[model samples]
Target: MKLRIISSALLMIAIVGAGCVSNKKFAQLQTTYNDLLNQNRALDSKYQIAQRDLSGATARVQSLEEQIASQRTGLAALQAALDKCLNSTSQGNTNISKLVDEINASNRYIQHLVNTKNKSDSLNMVLTNNLTRSLSREELRDVDVQVLKGVVYISLSDNMLYKSGSYEISPAAGETLGKIAKIIMDYKDYDVLIEGNTDNVPISQKNIRNNWDLSALRASSVVQALQNNYGVDPKRLTAGGRGEYNPIASNDSDAGKMKNRRTQIIITPKLDQFMELIEKAPEPTEGAAAADSTSGS
Candidate 1:
């Protein structure tokens, strides 16, 4: 009987030990479950933040695209305006010689101002064996038609056509300018462009601060001469300033500086082959416009 009782006690001890092991496993499982729940909560929080960031990024991209579209529209309108201003007149004139002579006479005035000794064309006259027999150098300097790059260009290298610091053409220069106006009045088919350039010296005058302003004023002076004196239509003439930026010779030498410091009267035939080609150039893209918009400022 005692042995049997001892056996019963041993069985009870075994059952209690099994119960303790099972409870330990249950505690470990509970810990693992809590950890998994914490991990899931962290993942959900990160996903929410990511979603908000993505939404904000998408909205910004849309706004940028809309702005670009608006700029493209504005650029198109600007281009149209430029074209309307430039291409209004037809290209052709049956009577081109009379206009040609007036242009030559204006150049001659520039030559006379310089006192060109050699028939070397002080007026920078275009060498046309066909138009009129070559005038003597003195005569050529006194009066000659200059053809440059297939267009007539008069040089103002001899003296200051303008008073100090002002774009106003001198009264002496006006008589010659009157001749050019007569040509424009007669030749309704041709176009006129006046280009102004300046020497390399820095100008600090109160009226004209920089070379750009000086050059622009010079061009405007010529345009005014054409319009007021010659009665040429204002629409047909264009004025621009090169401001020592585009010099024909090195500015280091005195002679070169003189050449650079002058105005050019360019008379184009009505065909306008060159200007037509310029109009065909493509407009810039939105990105390019944005990059260049702040450049001058």
Candidate 2:
């Protein structure tokens, strides 16, 4: 019995020691696991911060690139404007000077003729002057002419040509239009433009509701009249409406608005050669743009 008790005591002690060692190893493993978890959490926080920073940087880069592109366009426009002003004539100095002298001389003669007409009679003189001539007859009863950029503009009031908000040409105005068309047909070298001007008053008609439409329709009506009567080519004509935007006189008074609101037939030299000079003056800069984009990238 005594020997059995002693063996039992020793066996219990050994078992207890083995159990303590196992508990110690389990504690050590738990502590290492906690440390690894803390390290992983810290790394994730740093990664989130880095991601935000990178996104912000990318947005800033995109904004800067957009501004650069806008600046490039502005620079190109300025360059083209400068080139136009410098080399518009495309002729030698001697030839350009000669043309300028002739134009100036013509202007003097035109002004002298214009000065002879009384202000009260100017309107009648313009209407009856028989185009290309400096003199006028009262029998035709025409309005005054204003010249600009080598084109002459004639003003006709609403009472003379149309009723309020209507595109239908009056019978008297039709006769006037026919006469104008006949003269224009005779002159082949001059390019003609018909522009419609309107007062600040709004349109109240059901057929046409807006000032823009009214202006456009009126201009088109006149153009069609000219074409039908004279067989004028469509290529030589352009119609535009300046609806209450370009009032020649004050709109505060009805009389002034009537003066301001008129269809003007502008007779000028062809702009094809001038436009060709403008179109042919510059390179597209496509390759440069591509290279710039690559560099930006």
Candidate whose lDDT is highest? 2
Question: Which candidate number would show the highest TM-score if scored against the true structure?
Answer: 2
Per-residue lDDT tens digits of candidate 1, residues 47-108?
A: 64356435544664465456445545654654454355355433212223333333344344
Residue 221, candidate 1: C-alpha displacement in angstroms: 1.3
Candidate 2 C-alpha lDDT tens digits along 42-100? 55545643564355446644654564455456556544544453575543322333333
- Return the TM-score for each candidate structure: 0.43, 0.46
RMSD to the true structure for each prediction, in A, is: 36.1, 35.5
Worst 10 residues of 2 by lDDT: 132-141
